[model samples]
Structure formats: structure tokens, C-alpha cells
Target: MLCIGFDVGGTNARGCLMEFTDATAPPRQLAEVKERIRDTRAPSQVAAVMADIATRLVEQEGVDPAQIESAGVGIAGQLDKTGNTVVGAPNLGWTNVPFKSVLVESLAGAGFTPPVRIVNDLAANVWGEFCVGAARGHQDVLAVYVGTGVGGGVIAAGKLYGGHGGKAGEIGHSKVVPHGAPCGCGQRGCVEAYVGGRRLEERLTQDYRAGRSLGLRPYLPVELRDVDHMHMDAIIRPDVADAAAAAGELYADGLWSYVADLLAMAIANGAMVLNPGLILLGGGVLRNTKELSRRVVERIPSYILRAAADDIEIRFGELGDDAGVYGAALLARG
Candidate 1:
């Protein structure tokens, strides 16, 4: 059966139509639509955008909308189960919006109909990894997606754990410093505050401008492209490349140290408590997967019990930008 997956991120939304065959067969991306929102979109407007994207996929791909057996959305926001509303989505500038109702109505208006499921993006990400990506075959796993802000999802005992209030696996908020930098969530010392891409750039920017370090301010643009924040490399002007390389290395070092320390603590604690079989890391930061994973792995010994850590596998997420979409497809399949 054909399934539709929509990965609704903060900056943009991507939807895909896929034909799910089996566990091993990757879904075929029959059609896709990518749209960027200027952050001024209202809840209803956003719903329309999502509907339009889905409709385009069906029409462009020549697939019968009704043939879509199931559909799911992975959104970025705080969810209110009791009210069935997205309580607040700072990124989308939304609050107290009935997302499901709006989507359902929009689909109905579009003359396209199907059973649809909506979940937080992180949960969908974990589901994607567990169903067909890096965490496949594992009963217990953790998938962390590092982007503008770090986000995480946990699958325990073959099921996605969304926590009591749909706030499970908020690993980004895990405090790394007792009293460190400020975070969007209004918390201090969050792992995100320290290791998230924008913060990393800010650190480098401040350090470079202070004259306390090398005048490597020129590389900021190229190095700061991953998830809109400090990509490993972007070939640009020669001077920019040189500056970016130096800034990138400095950013990477600080990022690694912070991630290794906090992630290890979180994983080790989780290992002792939940004993996940594997931990999968992905997202923009993993653009330098080899370096990121190696550093994190090296710090495992200091955090986890030697015996428990021995059996655990720390791996990079196989799916790249497709992780959320694929996971959303998994929801549709189920």
C-alpha cells in the first residue's frame, strides 16, 4: 500500500509518497514537495500548506489520493493530548492550534482522503531509525538528531516512548553545565546550548572577535551551514575556506567535548536504567560522522559501566535527511 509521510520541520516541510513493500525494501519516493515558511504562518495557513504539498504529491505522481492507505505527519511543537492541539510551536509561531483537525479538514476539501497520524518529529525520527534505518533489528534504541537544536527519541522494548506528556527523549535539554549558556527553552546549560550548531558558531564568533584568539572570523558563513548551523565544510572563496576551516575545527573541538561529555552521561545513565541495545546518532552535526562518532565512542568508558558499555553499539544513523520522512512512513504503514 502507498503511504504518505510529511516531515514538518521548523524552517520547512517535506512530504513524500512511498510504496511500502517489506521490512528490508526501502520505500520508493514516488513524489515529494518541499516548502519553506517564513515563520509568520498561522496554524490554519500552515495546515493549508501541508495539504497543498500532499495534494501536489498525489497529482504529480499520478497516484490516486484514495490509494494512499495511511498518512502521518512529523511536526515540531509542544503537543496537548487532552486538547488535541499543538500548544505551542515557537519555531512556527503557533499556539493552541488544532493541527489534526485543520489537516483533516484541508484534506477533505482537497478531495483526498486517508487515515492520517500525527506525531512529534523526534518520535517519528526514532521510529524511522528503528523501523528501517540504523536502529533496525534492535528492540531498544536511542536516536539523536542534531540540527539547529538537538532533538532525541527513544524506542524501548520495540515501542516508541513519547513519555506521559509527549515529551520523552528531550535529550537536548539535558543540562551539561551547572550554569552555562541560555537556551531557547529558557534553560541554562542544556546540551543544546553548548553543542547545538548555532551556539557553537556564536562561541566561535565571540572568541574570534575578542582578539583573544586568531582572527578567523571570515569562515563563519561556510562552516555554519549544517542544519543552518556550522556545517563541516562548504567550498567557497579561498579566503572564506581558510577562515571556515580554522573556525570549523575550533567549533568542532568544543562541540565534540561538550557532546561527548553530555551524551555519554545521558546514554550511560539510560543504559543502566533502560539498557538500550544500541545508540544511533544523526543530524547535521554528524555531517562529520566519522569524527563525531569516534569522539563520542572514546568517551563511553568514562560514563557507562564497563560490562554494559561493552555490549552496546554506538553507530551513526544510516538515513540522512530521509530519517524523519521514512519514520513518518513507518507510522503510515502501521
Candidate 2:
């Protein structure tokens, strides 16, 4: 069966087409595409963007829209029990919106009326990793994805731990600083405010301007290299790493250390609560900042009880950005 999965975020919708045979067998990827939304913050606009992508994929791949058996949608927000209404998505400016219905309506013209399975973006990312990527073979896992904003997911007893209202892994909203940076979630000092790619970049620029000279001026954005918020790679990848790979290593050490500590604090608290079998790390932040990843991994063991943390294994996401798309597709198919 041919199925589609979409990992919808604040700025982009990453989708993949896959062929499914059996649950244990690896599905074949038929096609993949990333569509940027002009007005991702608007729910209607996001739906239109998804429609555009779906229509294009079906047309380009020459796949009959009617033949598409299922579709998976991973949203980066709080989802209701039905997984249809988005309770809150500050980044997407969505509240109490029936996202699946809107997207389905938009795709009506394409004749793709297959069932859409919706899950949280972070949850999909974790689930994808747990199923076929880094956290595979682990019955219990904790996944932390740090990108534009920080968020997490959990797999307990071999199932997604969505908790009440399907909002179990709202770890980004976990308070890390006291009266610190403001978050889009209307909270202060949340983990994302301190460690997420966007806010972290802002803080880094401020810190760099205040403390030291720009030793790596060429690597920074003309406006501190974070002008484009659509892609984390555009701002955080080569720019952050290239800048910090050299002299800026000394200059940026403090910022990376700060991010590492915040992540450790949040993850350690999760460890204490769940004591998951495997701790999975994902998102562009880890891909862009190797040293930061190392620092975070190094610190996790020290933060939790030795017995709990000792056997816990931390691994980077092997599937990159596409993890959630596959997860959604698989979920839809499964």
C-alpha cells in the first residue's frame, strides 16, 4: 500500500510517500518533499500549503490520489484526545483548530481521502526514531528534539505515552529559569527559551555583541545569521558550527555550556520520573552543534541518580528531520 506522512512544523511541512508490506519489514520511500508555507502561523494558510504539497506529490509521482491508503500528520502542538483539534500551537498561531479536517477539505480536489493519523511533531519524531532509527528495540524511551523550539516525547511499555489530552511530552514548557527569557507558550524561563534554536540564537547574538568582538564575522548572518526562521539549518547548522568551530569556540563556549546544562536539567528530571530505557536526542540543534551534543550527553549521567542513569543510553537521532514524517506514515498504515 502507498501511504503518505507529513511532519508539519511552524514554518514547513515535510512529507514522504512510502510503500508498506508488513509491520516488521522496512517500508520503501517512494518520494519525499519539503514545502515551505508563506504564512505558516495561520491555520488556513498551513492547510493550503499542505494541499499544494500533496497535490504536487501525487501529480509528480504519478501516483493515483485515490490509491493513497493513508496519511500521517505530525503537528508540533498540543493535540486533543481525538488528535484532530490542536488545543494550542503558539508558534503556528493555532488554538482549538480542527487541522485534520481543514487539510482534508483542502485536499478534496486531489481525491486523496485516505485516513489521516495525526500526532504531535515531537512525538512522531520520537516514535519514528524508536521504531526504525536510534531508539529501536527499546521498549521504553525518552526523546528530546531541540530545534526552533525544544520539545520531548515518551514511549512507555512499547506505546506512545500521550498522557491526558495527548499532551504528555510537553517538556519544552518545563520551567528551567526563574523569571528568565519569555516563551511563545506564555511561560517564563521555559527550556526552549534558553536552549531552543531561535531563542538561543537571539541570546547568542546579544551575548556576543555585549561580551566579545566578532572573531567569526563571516560566518554570522548579516543580521546575526538568523534572518530566515523557516529552516533551522539555514541559521543553526553551518553558521553556528562554522562560527564556533574555530576561534569562536572560546567565545561561544559559554552559550553552548548554558544550553547543555538546561537540556541536562530537563532530561534528568524526565529520567527521575520515567527512568526510560533509552534516551534519544534529535533535531537540527544536535546536528549543527556537535560539541553541544557531546556536552549534553556528558552531563546527563551526572544529573540523575547513578542507578537510574547508569544503564540508560543516549543516542543521536539517525533519521534527521524526516523521522517524524515516516513515523506519521507508519502510524497511519499501522
Candidate 3:
């Protein structure tokens, strides 16, 4: 039976049809599709948009809707499993929205009654890794995903650990600095301040403003006239670039250093008291993890028990962005 996996991101919803084969048989990628949405604040509208896409996929792909064994949807926000509602999603301005019901109803409307599973995006990513990606065959693992925002998940003995209230893997909100830069979460110095895409742009934007004040950097070139603050916003002054790059590099280093330290602290303090066999790191930040991983791995030994650190292997995520979808499909299959 074919399973459908859907990744409901902030701006786009992606769907893929996949079939799991033997351990050696490569997973077949049957069909893939994407749908973009404006992400208006209305939860009903969001649900409608997702429903429309799922409906179209069924029609265009020639896949039997009823033959789809299961469907998994991954969302970014606080999920109330008991209520099946998206309790809060700051990015989409959603609150108490019945996302699961909406998906079920939408699929039912299209004449298919397959079970649908909904989970947090990071959790899905971890699920994907645990099933087929970096953490495959491992009983204990930590999957850290650094994208526009940072997120993480933990798997203990092959089962996902969804803590009380399901807020387990919210490392993005973990405070790195007290009273530091403001975050979209209305807090100061959250990890997002230093590493999120929006936050990275903010840093460069601030640098541009500073250089403008000092009259040391040229204004945007004619070609950059149409560019927004984010695109083409790096500190361009040769001297400024050097200084800013130094600062940016420091800021990046400091943030990751703090992340590594805090992660180690969490492990030392009890998160890893059991000593996970592998620490699998994935996400956009891990895209350039050579230096960061080395730094973290080097410092971790100082924080944790030597024996525990010795057995830990830190590696990059191989599934890339599909971790969520693949994992979600696994969720639906289960």
C-alpha cells in the first residue's frame, strides 16, 4: 500500500507518495507535489488551503485515494493531541485550530477515509531520521534541526519521548542570553536571535544602519534597488565587512557555542543521563557543520562524563528536508 506524507510548513505544503521496501531496497519515490499558501491568520482558510491541495494531488496523481494506507501531516506549532487542535502557531497566528479534524474531513470529502497523523515538524524530522536517515538502527538519539529556527527531538530506546504537554523538543525557545536581542516569541536572546534566517538578516540590517550612520559604506547599488532588507543585505564596506564578518562569525560561534554548551548541560543535567549512543544533528545550520560540530564535540567531553562522551557520535542529518515527511508517513503507517 502507498502512504502519503505531507509537510505543512509556514509558507508551503509538500506531499510525497512513498513505499517502504526491504532494508536494502531503495525506497521508491512515486510522486511529489507542492502547494504555496499566503498563510493568512485565519485557521479555517489555512485548513481549506491544505484540503484543496490534498484533493488536487489525489486527482492529478492518478493514485487511488482509498488505496493510500495512511497520511501524515507535520505542522510547526504547539499541538494539543487530546484536543487535536493546533494550540498555538505564532508563525501562522493560529490558536486552538482543529487541524487534524480538518485534514480528516478534507480527505473524507474527497471520498477517502484513510487515517491521518499530525505531529510537530521537528518531531517528524526526528521520526524520519530514526526510521531511515541518520539515526537509523539506533535506539537512543538526539536529532537537532537548525533551519529558519532551531528545533530538536529525542528518541529513547526506539520510541519518541513526547513529554508532558508535548513541548519536549522546543530547543529554539531555549534561552541562550538573558535580556539579549528581541525574539518573535517576545523574549530576549532566544536561540532564534542568533541563528534564525530572519534573525541573521536582522543582524546584517543593523550593521547596514550602523555603517550608514558612520557614512563609511556605500548605499545599495542600482541593481539592489529592488531588493528587500534581507536579500543583498550583507555588510559591504570592505572594512565594515571585515569587522562585521568578525562580529558575525563571533556571534555565530557564540550562539553555537552556547547551543553546544546548553545541549551538553541538558544532557549532563538529565536529558542524556541515560547516555544516548548517537547524537545526530540535522537541519540548515548543519549544512555547514564542519567547524560547529568539531567545536561542540570538543567541548562536550568537558561537560559530560568521559565515558558517556566517548561513546557518543555526532553526525549530520542525511535526510535533509524530507525527514519530516518520511517520518510522518511512518507515523501514519503505524
TM-score of each: 0.86, 0.86, 0.80
Off by over 4 Å in 2: 22-26, 40-45, 213-250
| Best of the candidates, lDDT | 2
Cα-based lDDT for every prediction? 0.72, 0.78, 0.67
Q: Candidate 3 lDDT, tens digit per residue, 1-334?
A: 5777888767877888777775423257777778775545466566666666666676777777787888888888878855388888767778788888877876787776787888888888888888888788789887666666777887888888777888777766767667877877888877666656556545646755553322223333446545554344544322232332334454444544655565445434333455777777766654654455455556656776776777777777788888888888887777
Q: What is the C-alpha lDDT profile of model 1 across 235-286, one tens digit per residue? A: 2222232333434656445545666677667656666766778987777755
lDDT value for candidate 2? 0.78
**lDDT (10s digit) by residue, model 2, range 1-334:** 8888897876778778888776644567888778886455577777777777777778778988888888889887788998889988766877899887888887775677888888888888887887777888899998888887888999999999999768888788899889987997787989988888888767655545554524444566566544433322332333464347534465566666777898899999988899899988887877777778888999999999988888899988888877888788777766
Candidate ranking under lDDT, highest first, comes to 2, 1, 3
Model with the higher lDDT, candidate 1 or 3: 1
Looking at candidate 3, the ten consecutive residues that score lowest on lDDT are: 237-246
> In angstroms, how far off is 167's CA in candidate 3?
0.9
Judging by TM-score, tell me the better candidate of 2 and 3.
2
